[model samples]
Structures are given as structure tokens and as C-alpha cells.
Target chain A: MENKILEIVNTVLENRGKKAIRKINPSMSLRNDLDMDSLDLAELTVRIEAEFDIDIFEDGIVNTVGEIYAKLNIK
Target chain B: MNVLITGVSKGLGLKLTEVLLNNGCTVYGISRSLSPELERLITEFGSNLKWLRYDLSDTNNLKTEVFKHWIGLGTPIHAFVNNAALAYDDVITNMNLDALENMYAVNVFSPLMMTKLVIRQMLLHKIKGSIVHISSISVHTGYKGLSMYASTKGALEAFSKNTAREWGALGIRSNCVVAGFMETEMSSTLSEDQKNRIYQRTSLKQQVDVESVANTISFLLSDESRSITGQNIHVDCGTI
Candidate 1:
């Protein structure tokens, strides 16, 4: 599950011309560590939803890579 | 290509369906009910056309009745035409809230929500899709008793512009086709005098042909218009 999360996150970042995130720490801030703007975050959310068939934003905003995995209930 | 169209039972929407099907594309259409014309087309086209019967005014049920159904199909929708709309004729002071809300549900909310559905599907499948909103010249030039209706179209134009800006990076495009007065059920309510007064303002001095408008929509959806996005192409015959 962690590997899949890492793969999806890195792919999205790579598409946005960011370096591939080799590691995703639970405490890494999405906006600061990943350098994601509002549109980038929106695209990330959409990619996540498409991959898992879940609305990560259904409850609220998530700000970290861990939060996304946790929202998908991935271990 | 898989295309989704709203208000496909009549007027411009119906003409669009005919053109798309004739061009050998699959179409999924939604409307309150099937018209005889649509029924005839269905019989003639067979599997190429799929129909969903749902009232656009019932925006709440749109998820279950429309979007979810398309998602469940597992097919990538390559284009969307937000063509379904309702017009309420009244002065601003005399406008009815209930009617306005109903019209907004069909004209504004439905199209926006439907765009969300198609965009997600397009991104998932990596299909560079196009979306066209059907707007009215009434938005550009005001007519008496059309303020509320025109406001809905203006809202759509605004949304389409922003959608194009946001999604262009993803190779997905959005645009609007501003239509002029046409001879359809929507305009049948207008008296001949009212129609003539409206027609005189256009450079063409005639009602716009629905087929030409439908063909324009097809062109926008094609690869030929790949460079175009966030533009409101007026099919209004210089009505402004």
C-alpha cells in the first residue's frame, strides 16, 4: 500500500515538473515539501480519486502525503 | 469517440446528435423525455445512441441518474455538450424565485456538474476531451422579459472560460457556442412581431440555422479546433 501511494504521488509530481519524491514521510507538508500550488493540489486530488475511486476531499482538506493514504485507508 | 450531450430530444441538441451519429461517433444523451424525432433516430442508429431520461431541473438526482450511469459504463467520454437549458421570461421585478431556481438547476448547475464528471473521466483515461456550452445572444444584447434567462447563460460563459484556463494544461479544452434566435419550441412562444423585431437586429436578417450551429459544435469537438479554448464563438450571425 505504501509503495502504491509513493508511486502515484511521485507520478503526479513528476508530471508537474517536480523531482520524483523518492520517499514520503508522514510529516512532510504537501504544499511546502512538494511545492504544490492550488492547481497542483487540485490535479493531485483528481488523480488520487481516479486511482482509488474515492473522494479524498469529501470530508475535508488533506495536507500531507500520509493524509492522502490515510484517507484512502491504505496502510 | 464517446460523447455526452444534454437536452438531446429537440432543437440544437437533437441536431447535434444527428451530426455526431452521422459522423460515426457514439453518443449518450439525456433529457426529460424522448421526443418522436429522437425515437426515430434511435431506431435508425441502434447501438450508436444511448438515452437517459431524467429531468435536468431535478439537479439533486443528477448524480444517480446521469453522471454515475456514465461512469459505470467504463468508457472514456471524449466530448461534452452542455446544451440543455430552460428560459424563464419575466422582468427582474416580476421574476419568480421558484422558476429561476429551476432554470438555474437545468441551465447552470447541471452543466457544471456534468463537466466535472467528464473531466475526471477524461483525465483518468488520458483523453484530451473538449466541452462546449451552448449560450445565447440574449446574454450579449438584452431583451425585455429575458433578464433572468440571460443571466444563466452569462454564468455559463464565465464558467466555461475559467474551465478552459484551468484544464488547458491537461490537454482538455472548454468553449462556448453563442447561439442566435432559432426557430424552435423555445421560441414558439414569441409572437411573429416579437420574432421579427429580434431578427431585424441580426446582420443576417434571418433566424440562424440549427444545422449550421450543430456543425459548429462538431467542429469544436474535432481535432481541427485543437488550438481553440476558452473562446465564446458567436453563431449569432452578428446579432451583437
Candidate 2:
């Protein structure tokens, strides 16, 4: 699940022509660490939803990879 | 082009569907009920015309029922026509809260939700999509007992402009077709005298042709209008 989330995050980053991160930590801030803006977050949400069938941003704003895992019940 | 259009059972929506289909574009049409005309079109077009019976009043199910289950994430929606709207015609004095909310739900809320999902779909597919919202000249001109209905259209026009501004960088265009009064079921309730008075306001002094409005929509959806976005293209007959 973490690897898949990393791939999705990297997909969004690479789409924006940004550097792809090799690893995603639980405490990594999506905006600060990944340099994702609101639109990028939206893209991330849709891509995540497409893959997991769960909308991470549906219930509330997700700030970290850990929060997304929690939304997907990946703990 | 795979275009998702709402209110495809009749009026401008039906005409637009036919026009798009004739232009060799696939249509995913949504209406509350299946009219015989739409059924016939479905039979004629086969896989080209996909019909989904959905009430726009239920904005909640848009993501689940319409987008996820029906259109699917894999299918790239090249364009979205937000045409379905509920007409809550009443003078301000006789305004009913419940009816107003219901109208807003269908006209404003549902379209807003649909636009969000459609943009998301476009983003996922990396498609430079177009979104056209069907507005009314009533929004521009004062109409008797049409204030509520016009308010909904006004909201759409505003939304479309902002959507264009926000998504223009991504090549997603948003626009509104501000159509004049047409001879359709929507205007069936108007008396002949009232209709004539409305028509007289336009320079053409005749009912706005539905075909013209439909064609305008098709143009907006196509690459022909690629440079046009964040605009209210008035298909009205010079309503001053």
C-alpha cells in the first residue's frame, strides 16, 4: 500500500515535471516535502481514488502519506 | 469526442445530443426519464449514445452513480455540457423556499458537482476538456416570474467564468451559452401574448431557434472554439 501511494505521489509529481521521490515517510508533509499545491493535491486525490476506490480527500483534507493510509484503512 | 450531456430527453439538450452524434461524437446523456425520442435515438445510434436515467437533484450520487459506476474513470470525458436545470418560475413575492432549494439543487449544485468530477476525470486522463453550461437570456433580461429560474443560470455563468480562469493553464476551457427564449416545452406555460412580448425584446422579433443554440454548443465543444473560454456566448437574438 505504501509503495502504491509512493507511485501515485510520484505520478502526480512527474506529471508536473517535478522530481520523483524514491520514498514516502509517514511524517512527510505533502505540501512542504512533496511541494504539491492544491491542484496537485486534487490530482493526487483523484489518482488515489481511481486506484484504491477510496477518496482520501472526501471526508477531510489529507496532509500526509500516513493520513492517506488511515483513510484507506491501510494501518 | 466523448461528451457527457445532461437533460438529454428534450429541448436544447436533445437537440445538442443529436447534433453531437451527427458530428460523430459519442454522447453520454443523462435525464430523469427516458423520452421516446431519446429511446429512438439510442436505438439508431447504438453504442454511440449512452443514456443514464439520473435526477440531477440528487447531487450526492453524482460521484458514485454517474462518474464512478456509469462513465468510469478509464473512459476519458472530453467535454461536459451542464444543461439539466429545474425551472422554479415564481414572482419574488410568491417565492417558496422548498421549491427554490430544489431548483438550486438541480440547477446549481448538481452541475457544480458534475463539473468537479468531470475536471477530475480530465486531470486523470491529461485531456484538455471543454465544459459548456447552458444559461438563459432571462439572466440578462428581466423576465416576469422568472427571477428564481434566472438566478440559477446567473450562478452557472459566474461558475463557468471562474472555472475557465482556474483551469485555462491546463487547457480545460469553460464557457456558457446564454440562450434566448425558444419554442420548447420549457416555454409551453407562457401565454402567446407573453411569448410575443418576450420575442419583441429581441432584434430578430422571433423565437430563438433551438438548432442555432445547439450548434453554438457543438462549436464550443469542438476545437473550433479553442481560443474561446471564460465567455458568455449569447446565442440570444440580440436581446437588448
**Of the candidates shown, which would achieve the greatest lDDT relative to the real structure?**
2
TM-score of each: 0.93, 0.97
> Which whole-number lDDT from 0 to 100 does residue A49 have in model 2?
88
Report the CA-based lDDT of candidate 2 relative to the real structure: 0.94
Candidate 2 on A1-75: residue-level lDDT in tens?
Answer: 899999999999999999999998988999999999998998999899889888888777889878888899987
**Range of the 10 consecutive residues with the lowest summed lDDT in candidate 2 chain B:** B82-91
Task: Give TM-scores of the second chain, every candidate.
Answer: 0.97, 0.99
Best by TM-score: 2
lDDT by residue (B1-240, candidate 2, tens digit) is: 999999999999999999999999999999999999999999999999999999998988899899989999999999999998888887899999999999999999999999999999999999999999999999999998999999999999999999999999889999999999999899999999999999999999999999999999999999999999999999889998
lDDT of each: 0.87, 0.94
DockQ of 2: 0.89
Q: Check candidate 1 and list the clashing pairs.
A: none
